[model samples]
Target: MQRNTYGQSPPLHHPVPQHVSTVPQLRSPPPPPGSAQSQQQGYAPTGQQGNPYQQQGGTSGNVFGAYGQFMNDPTAQVAAQFGQTAFKQGQEYVEQNIGRYVNVAALKHYFNVSNSYVINKLFLVLFPWRHKGWSRKQAVGANGQEGWYLSPRDDINSPDMYIPVMGLVTYVLLSTLIAGLKGAFNPELLGVTATTGLSVVIVEIIALKLGCYLLSISSQSQLFDLIAYSGYKFVGIIVTITVAEILNGGKGTGGWIGWAVFAYTFSANALFLLRSLKYVLLPETNGQPSGPMQTDSRAKRNQRTQFLFFYSYIVQLFFMWVLTRA
Candidate 1:
């Protein structure tokens, strides 16, 4: 059997035995006995010519009807809404009631005054060449999704890679757009916080589909697909900061920065959730979802996602230590 780019076995291959066969005849299964019809009708014993549904007693038509029924059910809607839904709603409810009392304008003023300090510190994390003199692109070889070796080359739109890219990019863009709109207009509105967070979750999931544009362009591994798109988000933060500085007369307004970061953090969670979902998503049978809703990976992904949510409010820590201190 041909090995995949990864050292591990590919998902597509049948499991092969460890030892090579020394005696082929001993391993072969005895042929099925001839049916009486073969003798009565003067038929030859060709195995391939038997009924198509020999062991499985049905046709493809039966499966199609079962799927049709699933689509028409209402309970599936409730299940779809409830994924990590409890915690997300609870957090939003708290943020809306809590954040309203704080003087948002004063907070914005503080952030504006602190912008230069923040910007100088943030330069290292944002601008690699200026700060660290180093750069990293998407992994070039077997570190990719196939579990192969350092396989050569990179393609952003590879079949395995495109879905994650779409899921990530759509997530970030939608969240940013929503937060920017909210901050630009109603920074302290309760609805903005709740709507934006829920939007992040919904878009994160909705983005998983294999779509028309991707069908035309995707040709990379799943890992590279995800990483490349995330690179663009890094670029986006740079752009947002540059614009923020210009609009706020050097130190950007706190309102805009807070909401933008809020969007960014939730989007990060979306990325983790989408990637973990990819891991366990076996091919659907009869149009059903592949695995249990609460797999181990699903739980891990949710933990990281939840961490991003709470951590977003204190993003100074992330930028200061992780990004600025580099």
Candidate 2:
């Protein structure tokens, strides 16, 4: 054996043999399973053809195993049951209180109201003084039956909600139009006006209901009747705004004509309400004996009714002022 300068041993030389290829042979590892080349080459991982989840049965074998069990477990069903129970409870609560807030029968009756009745009530709500008697007779239907439905008759029997509702919507639309013409249009104004008006009406209704309860006259009137009466102010508002809009021609505030129309409508509405609400506010003074006890009771009732009626007019005035100025 011979050693080089680095002290490494050198092997003895052997005779060289000629080969066809001189390049060194190299081998590459196989491509990963599911790769494009492996898939095309028909190479697949073991158990690849079986159910992926079943292949790895144990929780430790698959990452999604716990998640799958959690989804399929009764815990989810229990949660769903709880959610459904809560929803049902909420629905029942709403159903129970729905009538307290809004009378569905009144809404249906209003929807079926006659156009002529609506027109007549429009005038009647504005000019209720012309008809001295507030007692309204049930309108006879085509079948000759006295229908208990609401009409434009001069009474507090059935309050028509249609005119008030339609009048409110009309007021908003006309107000929006006027705003646009004056170059002061705003989308938010519509919502604000509507919500404000509705809030005012609802507050008035609640106040009137409370007042009636305090006066021991709640039994004499219905909730919908108070709502109807409170809503009637919108008719006069519609007229005043419309007339003001036309007369002012979308100018700065309203001129004499606008003020004039507003004043007229205001007085008309006050008179109408005064006459129309007297029956509801006051007890039956007619067709009854007028003794000392009766007279005293009648006098007290009249005083209260007159006071409330005047307060109602003041409220109407305030609401009208807000709506028109808004």
Candidate 3:
């Protein structure tokens, strides 16, 4: 080796040979089995390499393995059972107590009317001049006691809330349409119209109930019966408004033609109530007792009859007119 001027020895340079072999040398042999060096060198045993995942412990494998471990754990199984029990208990509690807040039976009865009954009821309400029988039929129980009033499907005279509910909805939609045609439409108008209609029905029902109490009219009439009867006036109001709209060529203004139709409908509604309510206000007895008691009863019955007539004609006409105007 020769030293440079900087006092650093020159690097050694090996001489090149002309005949160098091209075949590669063999790699080192793999480490023995079960040794750390074999694992580090990626030398897994033959049978062990068949399923590397099976060698994993705890939850260190794939999703299925982790899930299987969770399912097999005793604490996890107990937690799942507790959760299922809690859910079943909650469902049972709701089912048991749900009826307290709602009258499911009465609701079912009111909405049990059939389509044919609705059509006939509508016709009778509009043209009640020829309908003679007005008493609601009764269903006798196995013990021969009157169980309940016949449903509207079984008796034409039986009252139902189905027609009233549908009629109220139809009236609201139609009134909204008319308002739009008259250039008076607004988003609030629909709710206002519905509120007005409901308020009128509520007022009418209260008045009828008060009259029944004042006249000592003790019949089997339920609150829904009064509601059903009171709500029928909407049918007449609907007809009046429809006629007015037709006459005005959809201008939404009711002229004399509307008033004429209103009058006819008012009369028909009055007559209908006059006949129909007699069954409720003055129920027939098996036989009349001939004495001073009979006279007093007759007087009371007469008073009830007069009040029913006043309500049928005067009350109905006012309410019907109000609805048409609304």
| TM-score against truth, every candidate | 0.21, 0.59, 0.66
**Candidate 3's residue-wise lDDT over 218-261, tens digit each?**
55345667888888888888888888789878755367787788
Error at 87, model 2, angstroms: 20
The lDDT for every candidate, in the order shown, is 0.38, 0.68, 0.79
Name the candidate that leads on lDDT: 3
- Runs in model 3 deviating more than 4 A are 1-102, 143-146, 251-253, 287-296
Worst 10 residues of 1 by lDDT: 149-158
Worst 10 residues of 3 by lDDT: 286-295
**Over all chains combined, what TM-score does candidate 2 have?**
0.59
Each model's RMSD to truth, in Å? 31.6, 13.2, 13.9
Rank ordering of all candidates by TM-score, starting from the highest: 3, 2, 1
